[model samples]
Target: MASQKPFIAEHIYADAQTGSTPILLIHGFNSNGAQDWDGQQWLAPLKAAGRKIIVVDLPAHGESARVDVPEDATVSKIVATLSEIIDNHGGKADVVGYSLGARLAWALASQRPERVNKLVLGGLSAGDPFAMLDYDAARKFADEGVTPEDEMTAMIASMAMGEGKDSHSLLNLMQGLGREPFDPSVEKPAAPTLLAAGLEDPMAGSVDAIEPFLDNNKTVRVPGDHFSALKSDAFKQETFAFLGIAH
Candidate 1:
């Protein structure tokens, strides 16, 4: 995992010999780029198909710098960082994001439609302001030295899980750091998009609520609750297909 110093991103190059379209994978809250994709075995198929891949660790996660910003980090800051990465790689790249990362991806695509060739968002809802509010409160709790109850922790872990069991430490770190909520006033994405959620997920309501806002989008339901869905083969298949790669 080579580090990008100023941006705090971890670059993972694909093994494919030929140059191809690049795809950026953004992980969810509490989880870094590697943790999100490691269990799903997403890279192997993408690399096999000859696509360039770049996975990043946002501000507070993984090897990135833990900067002290507002409880809810601004979406513009994230977009700026992503834009810089795309520019460095030429001009544009496809993007796939899950949970918190998905929210950022949506903001980025909306802000710079030309920079994203294809976009996919999983485990998120555009209509849920409560989700954002909860994140803010959680961050406050972390700052105040309050430990979240077991139920609350379980609720947080339900967002996304791959192969390994959920880690309380990671969830606590993310909940405490907090994330910015989505602003509906932002422009909707114009790129080809795919939105997905787990069938038994509590967040499913949020995903359904936001469907109308996506200009060009398709939706899919996979097995398991929120966390379990991340490990689904169906998700990987659908994701690869949406990115125009042979699954």
Candidate 2:
């Protein structure tokens, strides 16, 4: 893993030895790149398949420095950051994002269609209704100086997990994100795209909410809830196949 200072910002990277097709992996809210990918065992198979990988920690998360433009830092900032990394590596690359990362991926694919070759969005939808409520609640929490360890965070975890269990880690993450709007509008993507969510993910709820936003893109539903989606081997295979990398 290497630390990259691009766009005057610091982010972590894990390069693949074979470097076949470059794929950028973006982590979810409150989670770092390694914690998201490594914890789920998603990166190893991609590496073994000879695919170059790039993982980034979003602003206010992981080793990346906090941005002064938290309110201004919409999903577009994430897209620009990935664009900068892809440009530094080459000109274009495939992108894979989970949760909040997936939301950013959608924004990136919509904004800079040419910069991304392929895209995979996991555990989220472009205009998920649940996300709007979360956005409001998170903003309120941030205003109240509440950290991720707050009751609201546990509620979110319970909802996303669909098991009615509280997660301290999830609360800490919500606090880390501070307050940001969750806005996912319809945008045409220039590359092949895939949208995925856990079958029981309360956050995503149903595929119906996402279908209208996707421009005829592929959708995959794997077993489990938000946390378990990453653990699904079926998800890994489908994701790798979508990126055109052998599993």
Top model by TM-score, which number? 1
In model 1, the runs with Cα more than 4 Å from the true position are 1-5, 16-19, 127-180
- Give a tens-digit lDDT track for model 1, residues 1-247: 9654454576777665445678899988767888888733888788888877889998666776654444333567768888888878767888999877788898889898889999988887554332333544444444554444554543554442334523333443354334444654556788898998999888654786777787789999988786777778888889988887997
Clashes of each: 0, 2
Span of 10 residues, lowest total lDDT, candidate 1: 160-169
Candidate 2 weakest lDDT stretch, 10 residues: 160-169
Residue pairs clashing in model 2 are 148-171, 148-172
Give the alpha carbon lDDT tens digit for every residue of 1-247 in model 2: 8665333233334555544557788878656787888734776666666666777877656666544443434455556777887888767778888888887777777788777888888887444333323443444444453444556443554433323322333433343333344454436565787888899997766555766656658988898898889668877788878877775
Off by over 4 Å in 2: 1-19, 126-185
Model 1 CA lDDT for position 192: 90
